[model samples]
Target: MKREMEDVVIVGAGIAGLATAVALKRVGVRALVLERSQGIRTTGAALTLFPNAWLALDALGVSHKLTRSYDPLVKGSVTNINTGDVQQVLFSEQAIRPVHRKALLEALAEELPTDTIRFSSKLAAIESQEQGGGASIAVVHLEDGTAIKSKVLIGCDGVHSVVARWLGLAEPVHSGRSAVRSLAVFPQGHRLKHEIQMFVDQQGKRAAFIPLNDREFYWFLTCKEENMTGEPEQIQREVLEKYAEFPSIYLDVVRHADLSTISWAPLMYRHPWRIIFGNLNKGNITVAGDAMHPMTPELG
Candidate 1:
């Protein structure tokens, strides 16, 4: 196979990969992002960006674009479904914004030069060679029978990262839980408060809803892995049936959910201890984002 050379080769074009590439570009370094998918992968509905995340985006010089689009959440309320007890908490001066996953990906991707992201490029294997000065070069082999060499190779390929495994990192363990998420749209107007509302039942099930904008909001339900199954429509019905006792407001949001955006998956994360003592980097190869430390979304 022919060989291509790049200064930096980043695997995966998700949030971390794209953001890392944009950050490098800002500092006069060019990188090539390889994504296995055909295009940008907008799998999840939205993500909550805490103060630190915004600072990172700001450093990347793309926070303003997002700040203008997403409103900061000032407070939130958590309610116990069985006890009917509610706890209200106020946020600090630092802002916490919930943004559409797709928007975030696009914002970072826009900052890079055209053709910076190469879709349909899957990493099949990784190798490295020693060089002068005791440094090393990374060789990334793609599934398409092409090989690329780079001075530095960063893996942002997510929980199932091939590079992470190559570094001998343990696989992400299942949290014994699954979640169903979707974006609910109210074209007329949701007219809901710009705060987060969460509900938890005694059965270890938890759910939360957060407004993304005036007309759209994000919501998710966490339950035992065995509790959810089948197609999107079936899952939608299951949500309604399983949480029939939840507040009418939550059900209303479910009713308005855009089925096309509904997604279901088991939650997985790396053990904290493993991350604290694992081989995060070897030679010119390293891992970042979910590849390094994937955690349950609820912890976010």
Candidate 2:
């Protein structure tokens, strides 16, 4: 195996990993990001970023770039699908904007030097120890016979993180709820308001749609599930059937949405109590993001 050394090594090139690297770069610390996938992640629809996320980006010096890229969404409302009652959504100087994941990642990455992220470098195992001077070091073994030694090892991998599993953190708990999301496109364009709209029924089912643009909108459906089984095509059909009674606009969007962009995810979470009592770090290894706090996307 080829041996390489670095100041820090981060696993998983998701939002957490790239964001961390960008923040570190502001302080002159460059980390080597190892992603299991072949390239940068480009999935998911629009993500709502509140004030806290913007504050974090402010510290990293990229908040202006994000603000420029995404339009501001200052309001959202909840409507009952059965009763057709709408609740007013008001904000006092608070603004939230929905930004595409790919654009956000690209914005963060633009601040760093070239080739900062190494693609397809799946981590297979890790070995760590205290050096003769009592300083800690970790050696990460990749699947392709490459060993990386670093003083700091951070895991930003998602819920199924290998690093979190090795740390003996409790397994993610099934929340009995699953979700499917897709970006709906309208060739003729839509007259929907720019604000976010959520439609829910009494059966604990939710269908929310947020406009991405005049021609494209991002939507998601969350419902109770017995298991995370089913083919993509089957799940797509099931989602359509589940929300068959929703408002006409929602129904039309779901029906005409791109099946290829639709995705299914079973919400899973580790208990917050375990994070306080469990080992968060051992030597030079630690975890962040979904790896540290995997939960339902309700508050994410």
**Every candidate's CA RMSD:** 1.4, 1.8
Q: Per-residue CA lDDT of candidate 1, range 52-133, in tens?
A: 9999999999999998999889999999999999999799755899999999999999999988999999999999988888
Candidate lDDT values, in order:
0.93, 0.82
Top candidate on lDDT is 1
Off by over 4 Å in 2: 92-94, 226-233
The per-prediction tally of clashing pairs is 0, 0
TM-score of candidate 1 on Cα atoms, chains taken together = 0.96
Cα lDDT tens digits for candidate 2, 1-300: 689899989898888998899988888898999999887776665577788888888888888987875677767799997898999686545477777777788888788777789998999888787798777899899999999999899999888888887788888788888888778888898887788888989998888888777777788888898343577667667776767788887878887776667777888888889889988888779999899889887746
- Cα error, residue 224 of model 2, in Å, equals 1.2
Q: What does the lDDT come to for candidate 1? A: 0.93
